[model samples]
Every structure is written in C-alpha cells, then in structure tokens.
Target: MPPHARSRIESDLPGDQAAGKPAPQQPAWPDPGLLDEVQRELLNRPALVPAEESAHLADLMAAVARREAVALQGGDCAELFEDAAPSPVHRKLEQLYDLSATLREQLGMPVVTMGRMAGQYAKPRSSDWEHTPGGEVLAVYRGDAVNAAEADAAARVPDARRLLAAHDCAAATLKVIRESWQGRADGNRVFAAHELLLLPYELPQVRADPEPYASSLHFGWIGDRTREPDGAHVALAASVRNPVGVKVGPSTTAADLVRLARILNPERRPGRLTFIARMGADRIDPLLPPLVEAVSATGIPVAWISDPMHGNTTKTGRGRKTRSVQAILDELTAFVRILRAHGAWPGGLHLEMTPEPVTECVARSADARTAALNQYRSPCDPRLNAEQAADVVDAFVALLRAA
Candidate 1:
C-alpha cells in the first residue's frame, strides 16, 4: 500500500461498531503470500480512473441531493469477463443513454448516467457454499472477481490471479466505453460504477494523487451485506473522497443509518454520501419513512436513491431467480411518494439490468412470463430486459410528473 493510504485504513470512523464481525462475504483465500504479491503488483499499476473524474461524479451526486438533477445507475448484476468485448459494452451504454434521455425529458433535470461496469465482477453472496444438483457441495459463485460461476469443486477455489485479470478486464471495458462514447456531450456520457467488494482487489486500487479515491471505478458503493460501520468496506468508503453510497435494507435502523452518515460524511457534505433504499414494496411504507425522517433530521445532505430490483427479487417455480416488474414498479412508486412526502428528493434509481431480451423477469400487468430456463444467461441475479426497463422508467416519470 502507498504510504499515504495507511492512515485511511487504520483510522476508525466515529460511532463505528465493534470490529468483532468478520467482513462478510469475503472469499477465504488459500494462499496469503500469493495474495500479497497480487496486491503489490496492483499497487504499481496505473489506476483505472482519475481523481478528477471521481470528483466530478461527486458533484453530480450532490445535485441529486439538492433536487437539481436525478441519477440513473444500472447495468449487469455481475459483469462477465467475456462480455468485455465492444459489442456487449456498447449495447449496455446505448441502453443507459436511451433511459437517460427519457428521464431528462420528463424530469426536466440533467440525469447523471452511470453503469455497473468495469469493476462489478465481485459480489457479496448470502452463503459461502451451495449444493449442486448431484448432491455435491461446493463453494458459491461469488462473482467473476472471486471464483468461477461453474459448479465444480476445483473451479470454486479462490484465486488471487483472478484479481489481475479483473483489473485488465476493467481497463479494456473502460477503453471501449471511452472510445465509443468519444465526442458525446458530457450530459449524456455514462460513468462506470460497482460495489467495492473484494478487499484484495479494492485495497490495492486506492490512490491519493492529491485526494484519496478508488481509482478502479468512477463510483463505488458498499453493499447491504458489507456496510458494517466498522467493517473494511465502510472504512474504504470513509477513507476516500469519491462520492460513495450504501445499500439500505429493511433491517437497518434509523440510528444505525445516522451513525453511518456521520462516519461517511462527517462534514455533512452533499455528494459525499447516498443512501440507496432497497426496501421491498410491502416494507417501503412502514420501513423507509422512518429512515428518511431520521436521516433528514440530521441536516446531512444525502441523495436517497431507490433500488427496486434487489428488494423485489423472487424465484420461479423451477427455481430460477427472477423479479416481478409490477413489484419493482410498486416499490419504486412507494419509494418516490415516501421521499417526496418527507420533503426529500427521490434522487435516483439503481437497477440490475441488461439490454438484451432475456426473460429473467415477469410482468404480470403485461402478461409477461418468467424467463425461459433454456434462454436465461446471467451468472448471478436476474436482470430486467430493455423493454421492462423502459416500462419502469416510464412509470416512474409519470408518477414524478403527477407529484
């Protein structure tokens, strides 16, 4: 690690919880020496993003806090290394642009466009092991950054070498995004973001050219599973100057949220913090209001974005992971109404989506069926298709307009 980076990691944020809990969902790597070598190599490599771009993203997020703009951030639930090709990258970018255009026209505010790309290869899994169909027990597929999604014992071992590959893939994807998006107006350009999981990969990528920030991604966030106030993930976010967010789930208490806010944004800065509420449709009315009320009372400027996808996730009869479009829309509607009622800006929407026509999601209102088992492709969570995504944005805008 760089000399300047030590203080950021060692220092504890105010009101930090007991450091007893191990950082959840971290892969149990077998070789500590190999991991150290990987980290050293990463320290010598060029950062994937610049400090200035991250600062600019912070400014945009601040606008969302002020109700001067909105943010539309979505992409693959877990990016595949093979999908780093120009075709897949370009398709995703085009989809984001299409969504942003609609949001800008209806909301009459500049929509900050961000994609879960470049470094979204790692994920926090609910379990460390999964049972295969043949009754074989193996490690769960965390993400491409940790282990292979294939259900094999050998493939499940955590490998430090994959971190290097992830970095390379991130660089390639960024290259494609910049080349394809060159000459586009900044207002329509997309930014790269991902959950800052996988400490081995994330720790080495932190840089302090003058201000500390995660140079591996334009925007990075702490997942619901890893947002412990004293956990390494929160420490990483608190130590950086880039705009950071935390996934707010139903179980999170208002007091815990307040402590998180103080730890992350001690200065009460606007763009420095965002709380993405992933409360389910049924829980939003009862669960979200208190969080909003408590956080807002602190006078800390935070952008409250709704993540309608994660909270609404369900499984089909065949055991395939899927989500209901109606449920997603319902949660989004409740999210907006609740935020506005509290005199707060809805701020943005965070979704897991793809530009393809996959049937991983069902739309009961439209008579859409569950994803065909043979055609489903995502390695992790199901994602909304382009058509469903349009429906979500359209519904959200209609409600926003009325409100």
Candidate 2:
C-alpha cells in the first residue's frame, strides 16, 4: 500500500468540505427540486464516458509528468446550448484535429489532446451582479448553464432548467465531437474534456460511479475559483481516480501546494495530480519557482502545465474581454524557465481557444478588435481565434525548443 502523503496536510487544509480558497460568483438556483431532477436525469443517462477512458487519460498524463509526452488541451471558454449544432461542433473539432497534427510534427512526441468540450457548458463568475454605465444594476452574465444571456432581469435570473438544457446540449455535442474525430488517420480520441466545475452537473456522474468517469471527457481540471483547499471541488477530485488538475494562481503558496499534493495524491503518484499555474507574466518570475520547488521536494510526480490564458486576460477600454498572445507566450516562457531551474518537468499547456475569429490581441488592431466583436460569439470568456491558435501552435513549439 502507498504511504500517506508527507504529513502536515491535515494541519494545512481546511475541514473536509473545504480546500484551496472560497468558490466565488456562484449563482443562487431558484428551486432546489430542479436540481434533483437534473441529477436524476444525468444519473439515468448512459455514462457519456466509460471508466476506462478516464484511466487512459491518467496514463497519458503520467507519461507527460515523466517528460515522455506533451499535453495539448484547449476549447471554447464556455459552450452554449446552440453551439451543439453540427456546424459549430464540427468547426471546433476540425481546428483541434488540425492542431493535433501540427503539434505532433513540431513537438516530436505524442500529443495528448484534451478539448475543453463535450461538457464545458458552465463557468464561474467574479461577481453576482453587473453594474451598467447608467448606474443600473443587473444580474451578472453567468454562463448559459446558469441563465440566459439576455439583458433583462427575468432572463438573467438563475433558472434550474438551464442545467438540464446544458446537459442535453453537452450530450449532443459529445456525439458530434466523437463523429468528427473519426476518419482522422492520426488518433485523436484524446480530444475529450470539460470545464469540470458545476457541482450539480458533475456530482451525478461522480456519485453514480465512485471511480472517475470521462465517457464524454477523457479528463478535466478545476479552475482557480474552486481550488479552495477545503471546498467541494477538491472533495470531488480526491474522491475520483481520473487525473485531476488544480489551477495554482498567484496567491497560492508553496506550502499550500505541498498540502494540495499530499491531500490529493498521498501515494506519491505521478499522473494523479497536475498543477496548472496561471500566474501573470509580471508575477510568474517571483511566484512560480518556490511552488515548483516545494512540490518537487515532496517527491510526488505532478504535471506542471501553464494556463497563461486566465492570468493574462484583460478588459479593453471598449469593455471587451481580451488576452494578448504575447502575454501568454511570455508567461509560458517564464514557467518553463522556473520548472527547469528547479529540476521539474514542464508537462504541457492549457489554453482557451476556438476556430472562430474573435478576441482582441496584439495583431488585432483596435478597429479589428471592434470588428471582431461582430464575430465574437462565445457565451463566456475570450478564446484565441483560428489564426491566433495557429500563431500559438508555431510560437509555442519554437519557445519550447529554445527552452
């Protein structure tokens, strides 16, 4: 049997239901019974992913942590119910497939693709309400899984029905995703994933099978908002066998990281834990090294992937949410530098991207960004467009080679 994770994890973490930090911007569901219905429906549906698939993903992640392979995971920031239509789903999958082929050529190692789809229908917010320039207040624009994206109060109110709608959309999208991946001589079954938030959505899938299930999603990672050391998210991750990842933001302490490793993977397991650090370019230099050092000292192998998207995201003067590819590239460069300095493997990268042309970036002039807004169709968060993704693919390989 595996020995318990080096002690002090107990002292470092909060009580059973808590970990990481507090979950922020959760919507208040109007009716509790609707949750029960949604849970039942999800539980009754055939598992979107079988137990074996999640295990396969874990095995892949294990190889990644050992530096034998690299992970290439990305997708829409938040999938909308309508986006499940064949056109949108196929567009995204085609881009991902092309991405996989490119990475395989450049990285010269097996590329494990985890599309943030099949069920990435939910997202966490920073506020419960949005204040307009006229000093008017309205419910925040939570993802479609929580409420409609309309401007009226009635449309924004958290309706439990959206949960069921999201599930249906996710199921359909999964089917399209699988179908699209076919006929590709290059195996891309690895192109599966989800946002891994939304307790009501995930709990049914989890409770149904005590072990991890990724029928539709081969793997997933917890976002920064839900990484609280003693929170329900960690509890869910700990209870499963699927390879789990936690976003380590700027504030996460090295001590906290060690505690996380201990609590999640006490066995000194290699593939079971991944820390997707998203410290901004300015913060990566000082903040990332100590955490890598601390975790490395524990002797537990964990994949250290960089999610430069969240850390580099910003709002333009036009009130548009954007991220600079340069910022992303810069932070990733810093991440690799620190991991190597500390003698740890840099496992891979996680990005928010899409096939559509959207998002305001360095090349996207103010006029272009404003024009891109006309094409921006994401329900939540910004994603790199096809051109931007291509730029990232080439630039990332070049950067890693230089490193």
Candidate 3:
C-alpha cells in the first residue's frame, strides 16, 4: 500500500474512537513477505470505479432515505472465480435490473439498483475450520479471494497470489457491467458492491484524489461480523468517502446504532450511510422499533433497508443450511411496519439471490427438506433463485402499495 494510505489507516481517525479493536474473520496467510509483495502490486493497479460515480450513488441513496426512491441490492452471496465470465455476469445483471424495473413501475419512484458483484469475492466464516462428510477436517472456505472452496488441505491454504486473481476477476466483471449497461431505453442502471472485507485487498485499492475513498467498487458494506465501531474494518469504511452500509442484527444496541450512524456519517449526509436490518422474523418486532426510534430521534438521514436473508437461515432435515422464502417475506413485512411506525423510511431491500435455479432456498409451504436438497450450488450461503427472488419483489410491491 502507498505510504499516505497506510499512514491514514494507522493514524487515529474519527472512526477509530469506539471500544472493541479486534478485527475478526481474517485469513492467516502463511507468508508475510509474499502478502506484502501482493499488496504493493495491487497498489500499482487501476481502480475499479471512479470517485465521481460513488458520489452519484450516494445521491441516489439520499433520495431513498427521503422516500422519493427505493433501492434493490442483490447478487451471489459469495462470488466464485470460475463464474467471472460474461455469461454469468450478464445473467446476474439481468436479474437485478428486472427486479429494479418492477419496483420502479409499482412504486412510481426511481429505483437504485446495486449488484453484489465485482468485489464480492471474500466471506466471513463462523469457524476457522470444518469437518467434511468423509470425516476429513480442513480449514473452512473463506471465499475465492482467500482460498479454494475444495475440501483438500492444499486447496484450503491461504495464498497471497489469489488476491491478484480476485482483482482481475472484479475488473473483468465491471467491464461486462459497463458494456451491457449501454443503450437502455428505461434509463435504469446497476452499480457494483461487495462486503468491504479483507483489508489487504481493500487498503491497497484506496486512492486519494483529494480525500480518500474506496475506489475498488462503487458501494461497499461492513458485514455483521466485522462492524466493530472502533475496529479496523469500521476505520476503513469511515476513512473512505464512498457510500457504505452496515448490517444491523438483533443484538445491536440502540445506543450503538446511533453511535455508528454518527461515526460513519458525522456530517449527516443523506445517503452516505445505510443500516441494513437482518433481524429474524421472530425478532424484528421487539428489536427493530427501538433501533429505528433511537436512530430517527437523532435526525441523521440514514437509509433503513431489510436484509431478510441472513437472520432467517435454517438448517434442513439433512442439516444443510437453507432459507425459507416465506420467512423472508415475513421479516420484510415486519421491517416495513416497524420502520413506518417509527416514522423512518423503508428505503430498500438487500438480498442474496442468483439467476440460477438453485434449490438451496425453498418456499415455506414446500417439502422444505427435500426441496432444499435438490440442485443446491452455493459455496457459502443459500441464495434465492430467479423465481423465488421475483416472489420477494412482488411481496415488496404489495407492502409499498398498502403503505
């Protein structure tokens, strides 16, 4: 990384004020020298998105916060290196745009669409290692950016070389997004986003045109695992000028949520910050209203969106992780109700979905155990297929019209 960027990160910034300083879920790369070399190489590479485009997305997000627009952000849960080709990228964009179009028509408001592509190559695993069905124990698969998803020991080893491959894949995916985004009559467009995990990959991509901003992707978010108010990840997000979101789970205290809003968006820029609520269907009623009330009382223009996927995850009869489409909708309904009751805008939806017909996610009324086992393909978490995702959009439309 450049000296200026490194200094900015190491030095105390406004976001460095919170208590917990631990940065969890990072890969323990074997070779430190090789990792430094990779960071240097990435520092010399071009940014995936420009600073101006990030500003524009922030503007759109502000509109969402004001209830003048709605946003739809979705894509694969963990992007694979092999799926970086044009066909996969195009299909994903097609799915996202179609959903956004439906939102625009139904709500009579512009929809800002963001795809969890380009830089979504890293993930946060619950455990450092796992046991395979064959009784072989190995390091858990973090993401394509860290190690291979295969169960073999050699494939699970963290390698610095994969960092460069991830950057290349992201750039290629961005190229496809740009090329396909041209000549749209409806004037709809999609932006690139990913979890701002892996500081090794993120810090090097930080560029200072005048002030530092994460130029790796148009939008980056802090996952629930890494959103420590005083930790390195929060510092990284706070250091940048890009529009950022944080996953707000059930355990998040109202005071902490307010503090995070103040820390991440000190200036109270309308669209600069978003709080994505992932409270489970059973938890949203009691947990969310107080959070919304507290944050709203602060008068910060933070967008409130629903991430119904993460908190609703359940294990099937065979013990495979899956999400129920009906449970997701249930959470969405409660999310909208809580936000509206607190006088907060139900600004958008954040989802994990794919164009592929993966049966990893099934409707609640279906033979869930049997249905979730067929054609399951995600390397990490279950994602809604095209039809299942459309069902979500239809439900959101109903919620809005009734509102």
Q: Whose TM-score is greatest here?
A: 3
lDDT of each: 0.85, 0.73, 0.86
How many backbone collisions does model 1 have? 1
lDDT of 2 at 372: 41
Q: How accurate is candidate 1 locally (lDDT)?
A: 0.85
The numbered model that scores best in lDDT is: 3
Tell me the deviation in Å of residue 239 in model 3: 0.7
The TM-score values for the models, in the order shown, are 0.93, 0.88, 0.94
User: What TM-score quantifies how close candidate 2 is to the native fold?
Assistant: 0.88
Position 32, candidate 1: lDDT? 67
Q: Residue 300 in model 3: shift from native, Å?
A: 0.9
Q: Which residue pairs collide, candidate 1?
A: 359-371
Query: Which portions of model 2 show Cα errors greater than 4 Å?
Result: 1-25, 181-187, 207-216, 364-374
In model 3, residue pairs whose N, Cα or C atoms come closer than 3 Å (at least 3 residues apart or on different chains), thus clashing, are: none
TM-score of 3: 0.94
Q: Write the per-residue lDDT of candidate 3 for residues 1-403, one digit (tens) a residue.
A: 1011121223222223222345666788778689888988888898888998898889888898888898899999999999999999999999998999899988998998999999899999887778898888788888999999988999988888999999999999999988877896323779999999887888888888778888899889998888878777887888889999999998899998998999899998998999999999989999998899899889888998999999999887777789988899999999998888778889889999999988888789355666646788999999999999999999999998898
Please, what are the lDDT tens digits per residue for candidate 2 over residues 1-403? 1121121111111122323334443566666667667767766667777787677678777888899877878888877777889898888878877887787888888877788877777777776677767777777766888888777778877776787777778778878866765775434554567756766667666523544443335677777777766766777677677788899998899888898898888877777888999999889999998889899888988998888888887766667677777787888888878887888877777888888767445443233344345566666677888888887777777777887
Rank order (by TM-score, best first):
3, 1, 2
| Between candidates 2 and 3, the TM-score winner | 3
Q: Write the per-residue lDDT of candidate 1 for residues 254-350, one digit (tens) a residue.
A: 9989999999999988888989999888888999999999998999989989999998877766667788899999999999999999999998899
